[model samples]
Target: MRFPFTALPLLALAACTTGPDYRGPETARPATPGAQFARASGDTGPQAPAAAAWWTALNDPVLDTLETRALAANPGVAAAEARMRQARASLRSERANALPSTNASALYVHATVPGLDLNDSGDSDQSGGGSESLNFYNLGFDASWEADLWGGKRRGVEAARAQLDAAQADVADAQVSLTAEIAQAYVHLRDRQQRIALARDALARQREMLRLTEQRHAQGTASALDVERQRHLAEQADAALPPLAAERDGYLNALATLAGEAPGALDGMLAAPSKAIVPLPPAQVAVGDPAELLKRRPDVRAAERRFAAATAKIGVAEAARFPSISFMGLIGIGGTSPGDLVDFDKLAAIAMPRLSWSFLDFGRNAARVGQAEGARDEAAAHYRQAVLDALRDGEDALSRFGNGRLSVASAARSKASADRTAALTRQRFEAGAATRIQLLDAERQSLSAAQSLSQATAAMTADYIALQKALGLGWR
Candidate 1:
């Protein structure tokens, strides 16, 4: 059935409510020319996503499995999903009023009458009594729906829909964050494992050098001070090993926890050796566009929806101050017995329209409207801030990732040069061509350079993870 034309004006007015409209804030695009990474070929303003499973580029089966498990069982992910479910339920509740509601009922009544005789007095005896029972049955349907004359219901529905959208965006944000975190932890764990190996190897080399120095000293070819120095170096290297091992264990435990597994459960999976390599896409990452990012990023989308919800709330608060019109109806049949109750002659129906007003709650209603407006303003500010933050994050990540790559390469070269120096120094010492002091210095240099490389590699991998996160994109 069609609504009366007179009701159409109310809906049109509701569609024109004075509330803030959400639109993304202004943003700057990435530099077209000077960006560190080259844009992908056939790229428009923004690059198309490079690869869906970016982690696969690392070629690690264990990491892939861990990522999948984390997505499924991570506490944060579960919380996000629950929030989405709640939003969905709330949306359903809000829409329920858009349609009419119906109800049914039944009842019974009984009574007795007592009487005394008067004429029997002459006859010297008399008595009388009467009893009756009545049963009523009512089977009927009654429905009433608000005209939504001012679009209040529609606006409320709009707000609920926006909230649902925001909840979904939150889930996406949580997923993206989880993936980045897992990758970062995995990289750190691998770096620590490599460091542990380096420490052990350094300790072995130090012991061998100390043994040679002691042998030379025994033959009176080396000074006691030189032998003592070698022993001290070996002890220092040995001391470093335990800490590296501890760190490696800590990272492993962290990864296990993040993957929703008990600590040490992942030990077997990660028990195998691994290396920390900064997994940059074999090609440049395609960051679509700065404007596109505002739309694509879940946080940004969530913020926008929040702003819309806040705007709608203002209408809800405003609608409260006006008369709330409702239609009510009742229909039923009743008689002394069940068969008579169904008689068409006893059936009846009644309908009425009711209007309610909160005559004494002006202060409370005004305060609610004011509160909604304030909330809308706050949401607007937050939305703008979120947009700015996204741009800054992307730019910072790209800058760091670019520089970090160079730093890793330099550190690796330094480590290799130090290794060569240490090896030659040892050979020379063995042939009596180099002093013990020189050989000790070469070993220290090699160890220091190796440590620097390990640190740089870790930093590089971390920056890559940060870049992906900032881009608001990652493996699903």
Candidate 2:
């Protein structure tokens, strides 16, 4: 009764937490034109908001298949998932520490003695008393519970739970990065294929010009210098093909690896050039503001979770300054005969309560508290940095995506103008109203314009993917 009364005060204090409680910081988007964006808004596309699987917007079946494969099998994503599982397991273990534990055991012993008291056992023989051994048996359970009077165990659970959240966020972050990289590689692949096709068309035109120049020079209608320059120009245009083909191959191999396949596995699918230019998103991208980004970005969430973990650790450290209480109990039965253990009347039991304090550690405990405080400060700084970084990435992605649309538009206009010019020059040359040089120059301009258009279109696609990555899409 006295023990129960004395423990009442400790139970009441168990609800007290010693360290500073955590409060989430306020970090809203900066107020400006378009609110969260610094350069422009709606970089994620005009028609629809960016979906979790943003790659679907490309409308390329091959790209869709590849994105699905990469997300499912990418090594980075798998590793992050494994880490999340590990963190969850750790949390379970930490939570277990706050509960009572019990263990069961059985022991049997026999010993020989030169002069033993055999009269204590009825089974001992009088003639064999000098060499007889007494048999003893014990079977019982022991239990101990460390009362969470100072909340140390609870704080450990809190920290572990925060770490688990961080790990889950890490998995989402990995998915975002992996999917974006695959999309970028796929876009570059198609771009090279289209460039190669454009260059091949230009080579054919250049060859035709070379043949016409040679024919005119033989009739003294064109100079030998013109024939030589045309031949050199044709060879130079042809020279650009191999590097683009090689780049295409590289992207194919990279995509295969990202999809967890061997190199060259996707070659059969991508070796042939695409029949048309890869598609690009329409004019307006639907991007969220920076304020929304803080909530969506996995890395930002991970940073905040780590900060929470650090805060909990501070409480765990502070708890060491107080006393610890534990209740221990044991029950067993032992005798010279094993049958005696089955009799409850012969059982022995003990219940002991203990209280301990590290008051003599002097400044050792205080130093631990200081270490925890420093860790909390460091984590808070990281959380701030994460917010700033997310904002910067969002702003940069929007700028590039918005500007990419402009570049593509300009390239399209240039290609259109060059096409009109080339067609007019060919018609004039056929009517004998323009020189062969003018027609060849016009053809060259058209080809160059076409290449620029292809590259710009590819850039737009790449920029959109980067925006999705910055917004932490594709991991849902």
Candidate 3:
């Protein structure tokens, strides 16, 4: 059959699309894509960060295990994945809208007419002689398709696809955040445990010093005030234990929860204090330039995708302003007798072409188009802001990581000096050249220095995790 002349132009315009096309976010693109981060100096090398499991860089097996488990089971990550699946389903639904829909139906009707004569043929006067029973059967198919003359459905599909991309990016962003949080909590747990152990050791030594001071007093060489001073030092050391223990337990519980386990599930594995200190990240870290950061950051990518989706929605809104054309068809076979329903000669069909327009709605379509444009602009602004934030995050993380390295080094040097002083003091005391109280004071300074070192090391590792997160290196 030949196509209708009136529908020729509609088919010709079917390939035409409405509204603006998205080429990339112009506002969000960096002018200097090759610029280096200002803080990427000294300890941070000017190299692209590895896309591997960043937590494994610490070489702590427990941390690696926790990160793997958290990524697999974390509720936040699971929710993001679910949203991604939902977006994918929406995209599929939108694509299906562009195709024709068909439905099959089988209908049977039975009716009884009183005061109707079946044996009277066409004679109307004999109709009340008897009642007639009738049975009708129909087997039919119905199909309808709304032509995408202005590409509205196509635009909808485009928007849905971009939304799916955004959802996938959200999942990646969640993984990055979860990994960083788990690493931070683990570092904190180890830091607290180390501090507690140092405090306990210091308390034991202080108690021993108190006993020595009491003996000296009984030998008529030391004053009662000296014994009281030693006891006060020992008590102070003992008083510092509980808070550290509490903090250690808090971090342990946090790790367990992050791994999708109960609060105390990890207690058996992490509750015991270890003599080992918090592991330090490498001295030099690889931080790429700002250009790479924007591309790698999941939040930035998600924002860009949302902007694209919004841009496509403008097309959808613009297409809504035009008239819509649709075609519907029905094909059926029906007969009063059961055998007649199967006869090909008894078939009936209908074809309907429809047109609908909202041209009389005043400015409603215009207002909808305006609203869509406004949303597009808002998304563009958000995309630009996301780019800025990603850059700032990378720079800030780089600065902190660099400074953290210095802080750790300073603490380590202080610890070494304190240790040397304490060793010399102990020797002097053994040689009868220095007093017992002098050795105790030197040992206390050493313990304090060790604690400071532990804190600095943990902070440095935490900063490293932040830097990895900024680079978006934790997710596959």
Candidate 4:
């Protein structure tokens, strides 16, 4: 307190430190997240502004439950949280280092003189036993404090605080990725379910066609090869199911892992049916410009904090190059008996002021400063790259999402046309206006259209998830 000096206090100057103060990088700030994303608005059905829990837009309670559970219990999230706590503890330790510390200790001593012994008058006795003894007890508190004259301790605290901030951002980053993974896996699982069902339906229809073809072959209108071909088509449809079923199970297992459970633990919940609604993102998403994106993205924030920490470390190294000042004070009372240990009037006090300088070791200290500067520069580069990356991700996600919506519409149209064609072809075959080959070809077209639609829908849903992740909309 009060600069740790009293005599010649007027001669002592205020703490002056040498180091480059960090004013963030001198770069052109990008426009605030654009008023609207380049690919947002107009074509993506009814668009609405995104909320923090973007997955809730899907209107799937199952996904909501999954996201909640994953955020609450996922191992990744827990690990991130643990790291944050550690950073905070480190920061606290660093801050505490700037304060004074005191410790109490007790000392007892007994000694015998070589050729003398003390009598009633404390005089030395010689010749008989020729022994002298002394006993004393001492108890005291020792206190010491280092003056932060060069701000080295302060810089260390600053760095620790920034590190804590970085850890916080890391947790947010984990949540963002975890939520996105859950959404993507959930969408894929739903898509596979729909595809598998369609495949099964197609197989049943092909079986019927095969039976009819056999009847026709017996009646002499269909050849053996035609019946054989129908049988082959049925088998192909049957073959499609296995891969889809495998993929569905894979997604379910992934979901279980995301929720921090063993694989297949979520099977009971997911087994009910793949009715998960993979909703498209709103037509007009409000992703603020590049500035907003940079701040919102946890990785970017983490990078920025790392840069701050590095900058503060430069001050730490620079401070180390200067002289250090420390003060120690001790108070103690001692007597021949332990009962006199608490006598204040007899207490002895000592104070020490230490000044240390490594001025002779300037080269080594300079090298350390150089290392800190290099690390700061590296951290600055990382922060800049993080900003660039955030912008790139947001732009890319928006582009994919917008384009995916258009693709979904086209696929839906193709499926509707296929359905109509299959219906008309069936009626014509029944009336003898179309051959069995024509009906079968129409059914194949319908199957292809259904597959395309399912894929397009899944892609659109995935696009939404990606965009939300890029925007950092969830895990708020």
* TM-score for each candidate, following the candidate numbering: 0.83, 0.91, 0.93, 0.90
Q: Name the top TM-score candidate.
A: 3
Mind giving the per-residue lDDT tens digits that candidate 3 earns over 1-476? Answer: 98589877877899899989899977555687777888887677778887659888898888898998999999999999999999999999999999999999998998877787765363334436676777899999999999999989999999999999999999999999999999999999999998988888888789989998999999999999999998888888888998998898889899999999999998887765548569789767888788778888899999999999999999999999999989999999989878877898999999999999999999999999999999999999999999888888888998898888889999999999999999999999999999877898799889999999999999999999999998887877
What C-alpha lDDT does candidate 4 achieve relative to the native structure?
A: 0.83
In order of TM-score, best first, we have 3, 2, 4, 1
- RMSD per model, one decimal: 5.4, 3.3, 2.6, 3.4
Q: Which ten residues in a row have the lowest lDDT in candidate 2?
A: 42-51
The models' CA-based lDDT, in order, is 0.75, 0.85, 0.89, 0.83
- In order of lDDT, best first, we have 3, 2, 4, 1
Candidate 2 residue-wise lDDT, 1-476, digit = tens: 25678767877888887787778755534455245466765434333354377788778888888988888888889999999999999999999899999999898998776653455554556665365666789989999998888788888999999999999999999988988999999899989988988899888888988999899999999898989999999999989999998898899899999999999988887665547567687555676666667878899999999999999999999999988988999999877787988877888999999989999997999999999999999998998999899888877888888888889999999999999999999999999999887898898889989999999999988988888888778786
Scanning candidate 1 in windows of ten residues, the lowest lDDT window is 36-45
What is the TM-score (0 to 1) of candidate 4? Answer: 0.90
Whole-model lDDT, model 1? 0.75
lDDT assessment of candidate 3:
0.89
For candidate 4, write residues 267-291 as lDDT tens digits.
Answer: 9887736343445555555566666
Query: Which residue runs of candidate 3 sit more than 4 Å off their true CA positions?
Result: 1-8, 110-135, 271-274
Clashing pairs in 2: 42-285, 44-285, 44-286, 45-284, 45-285, 45-286, 46-284, 46-285
Q: Write the per-residue lDDT of candidate 1 for residues 1-476, one digit (tens) a residue.
A: 98799977666754554344445433324444334334223322256454245566666777889888888898988899999999999899899977778777666665333343334332212353333233445566677866665556767888999999999989889988888888888887777776776676667767878888889999999899999888988889888877877887888888888888889998988874554443443345566656666666788889888888988888877777776678878888877677866788888799988878886894998999899999988988998888889878877876787787789889989999999999999999999999776786688679778878888978877877777777677534
